[model samples]
Target chain A: MMADAKKIVQVLFEANNIPIPPNRAAIFEQFIKKPGSEAVIRALLANQTELMEKWKLENRIMDIAQQPVRILNATVGKPYETWFDFDQLKWKDIAAFEFTGLEDIGLTFDPKTSQLSGVPAQSGDYKLLFRYRLQEEPEDAPYHEKVIPIIINPDPKSLWKKLDSNQQDPYWKEDDVTAFEPLGDRSILVSSKRGRSHANVGSFREDDFAFKALPGGWNIVVVADGAGSAKISRKGSALACNTVVEYFLDQPAVEGMAVFDELLKQYKTDNSEIQKKINQHVYNNLGKAALHVHKKLIAFAAEVSVPVKDLNTTLIFTLFKKYETGYALLSFGVGDCPIALLNKDVSEVTLMNWIDVGEFGGGTRFITMPEIFHDQKFATRFGFKVVEDFSYLIMMSDGIYDAKFVVEANLPNIKKWKEFLADLGGKNEDGISVALSTANPDIVSQFSAWMDFWSPGNHDDRTLAIVF
Target chain B: MRRLPVYLLLDTSGSMTGEPIEAVKNGVQVMISSLRQNPQAIETAFISIISFDSTAKQLVPLTDLASFQMVDIKASGTTNLGEALHLVATSIDNEVAKTTADQKGDWKPLVFIMTDGIPTDDWQKGLEEFKKRKTAYTVACAAGSNADTNVLKQITDNVVSLDTADSQSIAKFFTWVTASIGVTSTRVEDAGKEVTGLSELPPPPAELNIVV
Candidate 1:
């Protein structure tokens, strides 16, 4: 605390650019023992008034540097207090400490203890100018000053800004959408919500979906995730889903389904030749619908006078048919989304579609790309799954898939699927869950609310569809 | 969780001893404080610092904004940019998560390099190694006229030049960097997309000029 007279003199001498003389400590001790020693020291420095002023100004920085460095931090509306330890300063018998910067932050300072205390009213960096005077100094003496850095961090939760998207735009859609429709003996529920990230920036939710009950006990559900990098991807996604669903509502689709039913029954009897026929029939019908979607997007892009790339989006859908013996689930995907089916006991989970994640280092294959048709793996993208009875058939965009499954491989993991279902059953941080039951009329809204769960960095637009 | 990893490569050579070094320190402090106010950056951005002088050192490892602390750094010795680049590349491999069956990797890292002088070692070797690793964007800044922009050009196409290494210019650069990080964090969270070009970033302040 600079209690020794020798130490105080040495620091002052060094700051004033005065060369230290030999035996200076002994001289200082001898001088302090004499009466009027303070006056004597002051008189010696009186000739160099400029140096004394410089020392006073420089002492503040030196004092702060000599003390242990630590950031003084506070949060808005949070209580905070920090004491200025003046022991490092060379000034002896220090008195009359005052701080000038506390008023800006609505803090109070006690001159006796040299402490600043109060709740910070704002968030910002504050430099407190600490002023102090020597005990023997006159009332008109200049106060020594020190600049201390103080930071006030903001409450993160309050920083988020939610603004509405422009509805006047031609291709604008609602921030959220939900649907419930009966599909033969079963029903499908779908929910899609704009992510918080989008809501914060007033951007559109670039995800869309469509589900319909078709003839011949067939149900079709299609989901699309518009490319975030693309300009009009929302329109592309909407067109992709609608074109596929509109195709299935035609008579040609019914005829195609009839041919598939015949091939399915034949394949059950004979495994080799009939199985190949079943594959060809499913491709001819469902695959045709996918190709037609691509064609429709191109036409729309040309009609809208924008590049086809501007309308980039991903497409995934399932064609479900309920047979007396078992259920047939034929699915196709051309993006990072996942389609999965769970057994009744929830012990087994089967991935029903191909995903394009991590293929080209996190680049997804959009349905709008023409090269996908020529790619060798395009034929393998469609899959057929036959199960005795399943608990849930879930299909979602990358938003939900990336958040729940993380990577493509986890899409088929039994444990991950179980945990995902549990999250749907009220195991999430938000404590919002949706039951897969037709008895609950608010199932759609419930699913929408559940989509608002916080997942740190995964806030892309979420779209989920379940056939239960 | 996908983190928006940011790597800062700063030059602490002998020439940066006085005003430049102190400006750099203040720049980083201000950057950290400003980023803390951003909800998206607070949630996703993780930062690391690599300082290069006679040798390179990772002053800070990959740390989230909530707990990131800046250690004191002094300027001395020659500029060893090669070692700094190599260290950053190795650190990215060791620290960044990769997308596998087990986990989702962080978004491609964002790299920012600032220097006031030319390299004293064969930096091309480090560049070769750096090219193998993927990053969302790498922006290099040549502070003052002594900083060779051509050398930085070899490191990245996104290069900016500052007239001087004073506190005001450094502060403006740091503010631009903070805005860039905020834009990126929000972009990934909202768009599920990565920024691959300089056009995607916010324009630099008047104190900084693009080194085309």
Candidate 2:
């Protein structure tokens, strides 16, 4: 057995091109004395081909454990809760898990359980390395390592407060339903309310509406619905509505006329052509106003150290010019808010521009979404109605429409909705249309309170602005 | 106001008689109590309980969560899963309002089914018919080893399995259900859309396995 061991050792040294040391014999002698050492040497020599095949199998098995760990990006100062459970990550065979590179990031990773939790202390990009090995492998076993990029963003909640302190007020209060100011005897009624469900949860109202009466009989009305999934959507909606109204009020009357002049040049010299030009002008101005609001929102987001998308919201506005012949209604909107123009007889109800929705139901384009400027369907398409016989112009967020107006085809039935509104705006004992026609000081309170009407399955912040 | 309708289809087969049945009853109560605390659920979610044994019965009609009361569920006879599906379909049709030219109707309904054993009656046809309706989300749970996962998969991709019908596992399952309801209710109210499918379901406990 000793001779066999010596011969095997000599062959191994020669095959590896290694010169034998003076202590080689002693090492061989020590190895031979160990139990099972001779048997191991014999087995290797007898089955070199089989041993090589087994080594290849082991390599393949190790490759199976080389999957990259996926960790979602985090936001600073928000509860950063994430789990890296072995079972959840499909690493059932993992025996040891180690995390590195999180020491300075204010995050915690449990090596024993692979649980990660922390509110990021700062906002920056970081790379965290995670290493894991198979259950049967030794502590010193080769581990598969994954480098995951972690991005922490500044929390928008604090930044939003810093940018606009007055926003803290409950603007959706039932008594404060009127716009910042009245629009003369035009009988403008504005209502905003936190949906019953949102109110129940103590969440702030996400819908906002504001109207500004421009010089020369131009009325600018804006409505914005903040993205619910966005943590600071309420702020986004408020900022959008206020910014657009302010932009229009600051602009000279010629810029508004330039919107019409640009369209007038494109048409033939005729009365219908004039009307068409007027409609085009209204559409262009509203679209431009929306674009201005988007740019301002992006700038505000940067000032507050937040992603522009965090202030995601839908913008719908109208620049109305009432003429002696009739009222020229120009409306522009991005997202799912509804705008309808009702004729004097109330028989013909026309939905200005239908709500824009993506392939997936809830995916609606917002002003903060850059794609809105590129998508012609949402950007260029504005609701421009040059009507001589219109009585009331109604605009509302999806919160009010989705309750009783949603249909299978996705398009809202305007005729049916008009009837529902007529019922809500019933006649008074004096035979006057008290809700729709009259200018009552309590109209804001009544409209805001009326939105609380119970309907099964619809609990969203409601906003409605009517120009009669 | 459009209320989110949530239906719970429970199994009361003979196999679920003793501790399993009692645990299920307690689990349901836990769910109701948890939902009541969630403002979103309280404002929008409407609860209904349907139990199936040898026959399927509507133990509670669609009622607001604030008024929802837990009833004693008694175990009996074979698992008539087919009847339960039919009852759910019929109940939604009869109770849920449809959007017409005049006004909007209720949002899509959410359904959850929990069972401990294989169905004794034909459930395939009923399940297919139920799928034809506009449903927001659907989840089916196999409560014990005897429950057929293959059959449950046909009803919904969101399927969970419980290794044993112990009190702890049952309680955990109900907790998960409550969390799911809270999430859906919030989405509906916030987004003004009928969001379907499971996006953020609470992870199942140790005794429970999510069926991929």
For DockQ, the strongest prediction is: 1
Find the candidate with the highest TM-score and give its number: 1
Q: Model 1 segments beyond 4 Å from truth?
A: A1-66, A69-157, A265-270, A359-362, B120-134, B197-199
Every candidate's lDDT: 0.84, 0.73
Task: Give me the overall lDDT of model 1.
Answer: 0.84
Error of 2 at A396 (Å): 2.2
Candidate 1 lDDT by residue in tens digits, A49-100: 7677768756654664455445567777778887766674444556666778
TM-scores of the candidates in the order shown: 0.79, 0.61
When only chain A is evaluated, what TM-score does every model earn? Answer: 0.74, 0.57
Question: Model 2 over residues B33-102: C-alpha lDDT tens digits?
Answer: 5676565676678889999999999999998765566667889899999899999999999888775543
